[model samples]
Target: MEENATDGLPLAGVTVVELCHSVAGPYAGSILADLGADVIKVEAPGTGDYARDWGPPFAHGTSTLFHVLNHNKRGLALDLRDRVTCERLLGFILDHADVVLQNMRPGAIDKLGLGAAALRARKPALITCDLGAYGRSGPLKDRPGYDPLMQAHGGIMSVTGIEGGEPVRVGVSIVDQGAGMWAAMGILAALNKRHVTGQGSHVSTSLFETAIAWMSPHIGGYLSGGAMRRPLGSGVTEIVPHQAFPTSDGYIMVAAGNDNLFRALCGAIGHDFAADARFATNSNRVENRRTLIPLLEDIFRVHASAEWQSRLDAAGVPAAPIENVAQVLASPQTAALGILQQAPDLDLTLAGLPLEFDGVRPRYRHSAPALGQHNDLLSEPIAPEKAAS
Candidate 1:
């Protein structure tokens, strides 16, 4: 596809300054960059974003995880602890940026004189987003939070493992990602509000809040019913025959939600299992799930997953073969849907944005930046003494 000036992306001409590091904050900046914003990432002087060292999956000796989250942004290293250099860069960013994003510890930015209140006072229309492990003020506000810690404290670990097994944290950093997404939404909302009111706003999101919000439904259910949720592994609590069933070769996921689908599933498998009084309805199936699951498992185990998938698809039953990351990447559906793209410069392939707008598609303009790669562009033309210290 031909690349236009803003690569046909939606957030064209927007400029964002990101004073953030690691997964949560940088991921938000990457999203803005994906939508065609000019994102400039500010890093510390010597060693940059902490994620740089977080890897065994390194690409060209750099952290692949860091590369993925920081794509399509420019990087500048500055000594923010130095008052002169800090003031110069702050002034420059405040002058040109539409949005400023930070993920520092509470009071850190304000101590540096670059807090939202200070910045907004200088540029009334500049939006600022502050992301943290917890909110700025609270009883536990000073406690440091990371993804795994949040998972444990947020109740996700309580319902993630095998039945009767020790609680397990999710394999991915879901809390960080959730917080990043919420921050992005807030930044966009604040920008829209600025359009009408001609003033900026402070947007704040925390990992603690994100994890709690994610646990609301489970917590609500527990509060209302006085029932403790046990880990069911891949099985859902309220649904029967909805989990992965092993086949001769691999596995397939089948969900028979209603009576019609349940009957159809049984018919498609050449069995009338649904006609049994114990499995005649959704409620019955849920109650006798142990019996129904074993029966379906036995039936499915007779064929390979692909064979069952084709047969079920032909019968208009909703079924899909379980796929790993490699299989998903190789699937024709993935290519046709344009879920992955190659970044020639970085010599890597990445998953693109999960959105489409009015038939317009986003483009990958550049690979993730090298540490402090844009320092020259960001350097202020100040006196030698000012630039020196």
Candidate 2:
């Protein structure tokens, strides 16, 4: 077995057994693994993770997306449906794993007798996370859900697209990824609690709940009798001059967050907008957006995006060019952040965790494993203490 290169990472000694597929669960496991958890990803023997085939953009015979989500984890091909295999897994978890993370189909884990309550009953130091679609107890609990379904049912799509246009899904799988983040956070909290109490915990989260949390600002307003927020294209409902405006060459997003910023923006653009009563304050500009935006739009179109960005930066007003994926990837800012990383033994560059410790990002120690690559562990010698415990 290849040794883990995680000596200095926070989770170096933690062990995670991940029985999951697709984005949300795998993403959570990836986060833990990146932070130096010894994550063993157990998949059904033959087909493995469904995400393996989720693309025409394949690399190493699997989807690039799958590789991106599954790196830094060992792979085990064990069919839980097999009686002996299931028992073997249970034994492994009770003996070795500190955490078990899963987003299997609803009711599947309990059906297999591998539910959090079941496992934690045997091993008081074990943590388990259930990343569900709807929730643990709800009408839609048993129904399978994907990212788009949650996005639509959870009301994100209703406020996502252009104003006066049919609602559109956000380009990214925000709900799945957010739910995964929540699951990771809950597990981390449980781990902390375990350290203090010598008892493990069951952490539960769902895509539906994550969606609601993301919609807090909107929901708060609507619950307080504010009208339903309509989509504002690249603009926001509360802030005028906070959207992308067309430039002579492309688009630049201008954000005049306060009256002072608005004044600076006006000065930078050579417009006396601050002197105009209808646009002097943020509230005034918001109230008069219909009039103010069109006038500003005409002025913005006279300059290229680069020219406006320079002016806004010089004036200390917040602004950015509307960059696409390729543009952002090629940017100096992106390079400076060191967020994109290449795996040590693969010809792949992927986005790393969006955080660092002591100014050092976690290393991409290895590529994602091939299916069942570490299945020999079923026969490998278990540490005597681990086995006895």
Tens-digit per-residue lDDT, 27-91, candidate 1 = 88888888877788898977899998889788866788887888777778889999998987787
Determine which window of 10 residues in candidate 2 has minimal summed lDDT: 380-389
Q: What would the TM-score be for candidate 1 when compared with the true structure?
A: 0.91
lDDT score, candidate 2, position 230: 85
Who wins the TM-score comparison? 2
The global C-alpha lDDT for each of the candidates, from Candidate 1 onward, is 0.82, 0.88
Write one digit per residue (lDDT tens) for candidate 2, span 13-39.
899999999999999999998998888
Model 1 per-residue lDDT at 12:
70
Candidate 1: residue 109 Cα off by (Å):
1.7
- Model 1 lowest lDDT segment of ten: 380-389
Superposed Cα deviation of residue 365, candidate 1 (Å) = 0.6
Clashing residue pairs, candidate 1?
none
